[model samples]
Target: MCLLLNLFHLDLETLEQSNVDGPYEPMEADATNREHETEQGGTRFSDFIPLDFEEEEAVEEAIRRSLEEETVQVPQESRSIKTLTTEEITGIVKAHSEMVVTEGFRSIIVSRRNVWTSAIRQFRRPRFVESTDMLYVTFASDKNSTEDAEDLGGPRREFFRLLVKAIFQESGAFEESPNGFIPRLSVSHVQNRVYRTIGQMMSTIIVQGGECPALLSSVVLDYLLTGRMFDIRVSPEDVADLELRDSLKTIDQATTDDDLQRAIESCESWRYQIEGLPNPVTMDNKDAFVKNAIIFHVLLQRKSCYDQLAEGLECYELLPLLKENLPLRVLLEMPKVRSDLTADVVATLLKPSYSVLGSNKRPKEELMVVKFRDFLNSVQEREVEECLHGRTLTEAEKTFLRTLNPGHILAFVTGSSRVPAVGFQPSPKLSFVHNENKYLPVAHTCSNELEIFVNSKNLADNDEFEYNFLVALMNGANFSAV
Candidate 1:
C-alpha cells in the first residue's frame, strides 16, 4: 500500500504552470461520458477501506460486550460501608436524583468549553460505567444545525483530550513527580468531594472510550489498588517542600562526617517533622533518619489526600479493571505518559474511502487521497530540502508541511493531540468533499472522518488545495490552547 502511495507525488513546479487553477469548465460531452461510465461501473478504487454499516455495527457490538465484561463485581463481604451522617446522606441522595434524570439518554453531550463540568455531571450518573452507550461530543459550530448527527468518534476523542488536560493542571488534585502525577491534599476540594468527581471522570473515559489517565505515580497507583504502600522509593525530587527536599538531598550527598553532621543539624531545625529520628543522630543512624523523613513527608504527610483519591477511584469500581488489565494498569503509572506520535503511525491509522471505480468523482477523489498520502510521507520522512524524494515543493508548501506536526493532523481528525492509550477505536476515514466549490477540508470528529476537496484537475492544481487544507486546519483545529 505504501509503495502504491509513493507513486503519487506533488511537483510544485508543474502545479504552478497548470491551467486547472482557472475556473473549472467541464465539457458537457465529457461529463455525460463520465456519468455513463460510472453507471456502467467501469472501474473502482477497491483498495480504500470504507467503514460500511456492517463493520460499524460490529465495532459497536464488540465495544458493548467489552463494557459488560470489564465492569468489576465486588464481593459484598469485601465492600466497605460507611454510616453517613444526615447531611452526607441527604447530599448523596440529592446528587443521585440529579444523575437519574440523564439515565434515559443513550449518550452524554459535552462541548469543548464545558468538558470538565459535563464530564463530572454525566460520569456521576449510576449507569455511566455499567451502561454500554457511547460518548458523544458536540461542537460550538453545531448550534444552528437541526440534525441527529453528532459524535461518531472524533468529538468523543476531542472531549477526552480536553477533559484530561483540564484534570491534570498544576492547581488540580494531582502534582507532577519523577514517577508521574501523585495526588495532593487540597482541603477545600476534598471537602467538596472533588476527588470523587475526578475519579468518576477517569473511570468513565477509560470504560467508555479506552482513554487512560496515563499520568499517575506507580507507587500511588499500587497503593490505590492494594491499600498498602509497597516498595516506596521517594527521592529528594519527590519532596514538594523545597527546604525539606534540599535537606534530604544534602543528607544523601554528604560524603564526610562533617558534611553529614551539617545536613543533619539543618534537619534538626525541623525536628518535630522527623517522625522517628533518634535525638542527636550520629553517622550510624543517619540513613535511617533520612529514610524516615522521606516516608513521613511523601507518604505519611499526604496519606489522607491519597486516601480520598482512592475513595473516589474505588467508588466507580475502577480498581478491579486496573487489577485485571495488567498492561493498562501499567500504562497508568508509566513515567513517559504519551506515545511518540510519528508520521507513519498517523498515516497507518487513516483509512480512505473512495467512490465507485467508474464514477466521475472517483478520479479526483483518488488523486486527493494520493496527495494526502504524499503529505503524510513528506512529514514522516522529514524532507527538509525543497525536493521530497524526487518531487519538488515550493517554499510556501514546504513551510506549510513543516508547520503541521503529526499530532496536529491526528487531533484534527481524531480530536486528541496525543494518541489515546488504547489507540483510535475506528480508524479515521478519508473522504472527499461533495461540493467542488468548497476548496477547504472539513473534519467530522465524531465519525473520525476528514473530508477533502477533490475538484483539482490533477496533481498540478494542489497548491490551492494545500492552502485551503491549511486554512481549515488552523481554523478548525483549535486544540493548542487546551
Candidate 2:
C-alpha cells in the first residue's frame, strides 16, 4: 500500500510539472482574432445566432411576415395542436426582443433564453398580445381542476414562484430586501396585495415562453385576461357586490359633467400609502380603497379630487360627501377626549370672562375665557417642549392641524378607548354672541393653531368695560383711591 501511494504521488507531481514545462496549453476563445474556442457552459458569440438574436430591423421584418402567415392544422388525438416551427420561434423571439420594455429586461432575456423557454413549456403555447404588441402565455387552466379546492402540487407551485421572481428581477423595477425583491409597481408607493399577487402571476407567465416574452406584455395581459374583481365570481354574494359597484361606476361616469371633471383635476391629488403592504387597488378592493380615500380626502378638504375619485370608484353612496356636507356623523355618545395641557382646552374656552385692561393700581389683566389663538400663542413654547413628551410633532400631525381650521369643532375624546370622530364645521355655531360658552372636545389639539377671528370689532368695543368701574359699582373696589 505504501509503495502504491508513493508511486501515485510521484506520478501526480510529474504530471503537474510536465504540463507546465511542456508545450501544453488550452486555447482561449478569441472572437477578435476570429478563432473560436470549443468551451462548455460558457457563451460564445456563435451561440446567439442559434438563439435567434438578430438585428432589430431584420427581426421586425421576419416577425411581420410570420404574423401574416397562418398555421397549418395538425391532428393529434382528435384535437388540433399548433406546433411552433423554428421560423415561428425565431420570429416570436425577435419580435419580443424588439418590443418596448424597461431597459434591463432585454439583456436578461438574451442571457437566459433556454432556461426561460423550458419554463414556458410548463404552460400552454404562447399567444400574441395585440394590446401590448408582444407574445404572452399563461398557466394551463386545469380541465381536471377541482372546484374551490387546493391543488396539492406544492413543489411545482414553488418553482413557479421562483421563476416569476427571476423574471421580475430582469425588469429592474423591484427593490432588494433581506427576504427577496419586492416589486415597486406604482408611483403611489403602495398597492393592493391581491394586485401584487396578480403581478406575480404576470411575471411568472412572462418568463415561461416560446422564445422570449416581454414583461410588459404579461403585465398588460394580467389586467386584460383574469381579474375576477369586476367579474361575477362563483360566489353569489361577491357577484352581487361586483355588479353593484360596476353599476355605480357607470352611473357616476355618465353623470360626470365638465364641472365634475374640473373638480377631479382641481382636487389636490394625494395617495394614501398604507403601512407594511403596498398594492394597486384591484376590482376586489376598489370599494374599500374608495371608502378610505373618502375619509382621508373629505376630512382634509381635498374635496374635488377625492370626491371625483370616489365617484370614479362608483361609490354612489359616498357622492353626498362630495357636496362637502358629511352629516354630523361624529357621535355625541362617544367619549369626549381631553386636551394634553394642564388645563382643559374646551372647558377653559367655555368659561365666562370679559377682556379687560390693567386696573389703575394693580395694572394687571385677568380672564377665564381667552381667544383660541391667544391661548395657543400663550402655550406654544411650553407645549412644543413638553406636550409630545419626548417626541416632537410629526408631519402628519402638523398637516392635520393645518387642515383642521379653527372654526372646525375640535372635539376631545372622552372615552378612554374610543377615538374622536370630528365633524366638519362649514360655518360656526355660536352658543351666544361672541361664542361665550361653546367648545368641542379635541384629541391632541395643537397649541399653535391659526387665528379665526369671530368677534365683530364694534360689538367687542361695546362690550368692553373697565374692571375697576365694575368692581367699584359692585362695592368690591377701593373707592378711596379714586
TM for every model, in the order presented, reads 0.65, 0.15
What value of lDDT does candidate 2 attain over all alpha carbons?
0.25
What lDDT does candidate 1 reach at residue 206?
54
Model 1, C-alpha of 124: deviation from truth (Å): 5.8
Most TM-score-accurate candidate? 1
**Tens digits of per-residue lDDT for model 2, 19-90:** 332321112222212122112112111000111222334433433342333222211221243455434444
Model 1 scores a C-alpha lDDT of 0.54
Error of 1 at 209 (Å): 0.6
lDDT of 1 at 421: 38
Candidate 1 has its poorest 10 consecutive residues by lDDT at: 44-53
* Model 2: CA > 4 A from native: 1-313, 319-366, 370-375, 381-482
For each candidate in turn, give its C-alpha RMSD to the true structure in angstroms: 21.1, 33.6
- Given candidate 1, what's the lDDT at residue 326? 32
